[model samples]
Target chain A: MNQLNSTQLETLRNDLKARGLSLFVLKDELLDHICCLIELEMEKGISFDEGRQIVFKNFNSAEMLRNQKKTKWIYQSKKFKRKFKSVLSAAAVIMLMMVGGVEAQETPDGHPIYGDCELASGFGIRRDPIYKIKRMHSGIDFKAKAGTPVVATADGTVLEAVSNPDGYGNKIIISHSGEYKTLFGHLSGFNVKTGDKVRKGDIIGYVGSSGRSSAPHLHYEILQGDKKINPELFISK
Target chain B: MYSKELMKGTLKTIVLKLLKEHEKMYGYEITQKVKDLTQDKIQLTEGALYPTLHKLESLGYVYTEKKEYNGRTRKYYLLTESGQAEATEKINEFAEFVLTMKFIFNSKLAAE
Candidate 1:
């Protein structure tokens, strides 16, 4: 298995680009993978062209990667779409149900719930004890006495921290890596402001009944983009 | 050989869970690891592995760092915070699935 000459590697890059595998990261990754596979095959007495063919064959359809067709594959028939959606959603539901049983719940890469607080409410729709009407609660509320320090659930850059705000009287929103954004709502005071970088358990505010609420609580929400998933999905209680 | 169709649904979960246990891994290392663990019975073709890893990267569950090793560039994958939580959840769920399969299989064996 000879190392691919720079000229051959260049040709492969152009071929891949012409086939719609253009993202540098994706291209480099695939290039390395294919080169390695080809080397293995060539070591077994196959020529480079034959090795390349075998590699492409194992991938099933390098031709299908051609730019325009890549789009088509994603937006194809409704039948394909339906089947794909069911498989993904099934996995999601299973993930949610199986979380609490393991010690891996510590989430080695993420920060734990900050500043010790008790759960006032969990996520989901419920009869609002305050307004006496059914309402969808987008986040979990932790019972913290007024002025108890509220901390960031994970490391991130503060998106906003409002003081004496309306509706949500005091709120702090922090955006973390990996598409995560956390909101600490109805605070008594602000310790961090917009654009401030914070770490896990960093004090960002104080608990209070500042917003439209009935008691001193920290309204904690974890969002992936704008989608509000259950916070309990990620953090252990 | 393992059924490719059966392997399809679990590949992402497997990759995420793998990265969770190790600090970082390159593309070929993951394939070799899976194959070794499964005793060559479950070779992950790059076709199956890379797309899944790329999808996970795009979704921000995992991210990559590139380094030069022995005159070649290798891309190492690591779990982001979200990826860590996701891997935990996915692995737990997969364990439950395998257990359920075993239970069903045992009952059928007894009945037979």
Candidate 2:
């Protein structure tokens, strides 16, 4: 195998990092994989620099970025699942003693509504976009152009799909089983009505500035029982 | 080569099966093996392969260890016990699916 000299390896790493592969968890693996490819090219009588160029051309930055996002999502989801499993085991033991039975439900894991859209604002206390006063932000805000289709994060029945000019501008709340519900706020229009059953990824509304004063975006919330949880935990690219 | 859609959902099973047989393999080795096995008919790109490998690692189906090789770090992936079980399950499931597909195609041919 043709070995990459230290300088050549450094150049390869820099180029990949510059292309946004630096933060990826599999960064070292990818670098090594690319190096192996370059070495194979070199064995074909190609110089290291020429081989590097040829190998680099095969990597699409956008697609590679998508892969990085996907791997990160899988890692987080697995971690969450592990944590949830332990919690469930403890809860089950307590519930069994109390009620002599337990009902298990699947947690919601959903594709991002805007497919890796920019997060304009996140959950928790932050300056209110409207008033500039620090307050609890109920949901995460995703920047989207007006009229972008908003999909249901999980299969559920629409509980409230109403148009109002107030707090959550044209909002829709879908109540899923297992005491879970999702709210879609700032929609331009609704695709379903109250009591309509929608599957995961079903287009339920369009992004708009119907209620709150802001640029076009989607305000999304995930609620378990009566308490709101961070939507970022369940959403993935 | 098959369209990406045709290859969809098989990458994980393929990688797991490969790891199960090989005991351990690196990312590039797995890709090269797939290419050779399929006679260059199915090429697994870096974009598809690495993410699947990472997902498997996260799911506890595979574990990795870094070793020094040729003055650079090389990561090798091997199946966990659960990964071994999963590989058998996935391979069986895929085999059954292929048989069903063949049955359907054969029936369509008979009808025609």
Alpha carbon lDDT of each predicted model: 0.76, 0.86
Instruction: Pull out the clashing pairs in model 2.
Output: A169-A211
Error of 2 at B23 (Å): 1.4
Specify the poorest-scoring 10-residue window by lDDT in model 1 chain A: A101-110
The residue-by-residue lDDT of candidate 2 on A72-149, one tens digit each, is: 888788888999999999998888865632123324567536443578999999988789999999889988888888
DockQ of 2: 0.46
lDDT of 2 at B48: 90
> Where does model 1 sit among the CAPRI classes?
incorrect
State candidate 2's TM-score.
Answer: 0.58
Using all chains and alpha carbons, the TM-scores for the candidates as numbered come to 0.46, 0.58
Q: Give the per-residue lDDT digits (tens) of candidate 1, residues B1-112.
A: 6687889888888898789889999888899899888899888876567767766775678888998643456799999999999999999999999999999999999999
User: Candidate 1 — which residues are off by over 4 angstroms?
Assistant: A18-20, A23-25, A45-50, A62-237, B68-73
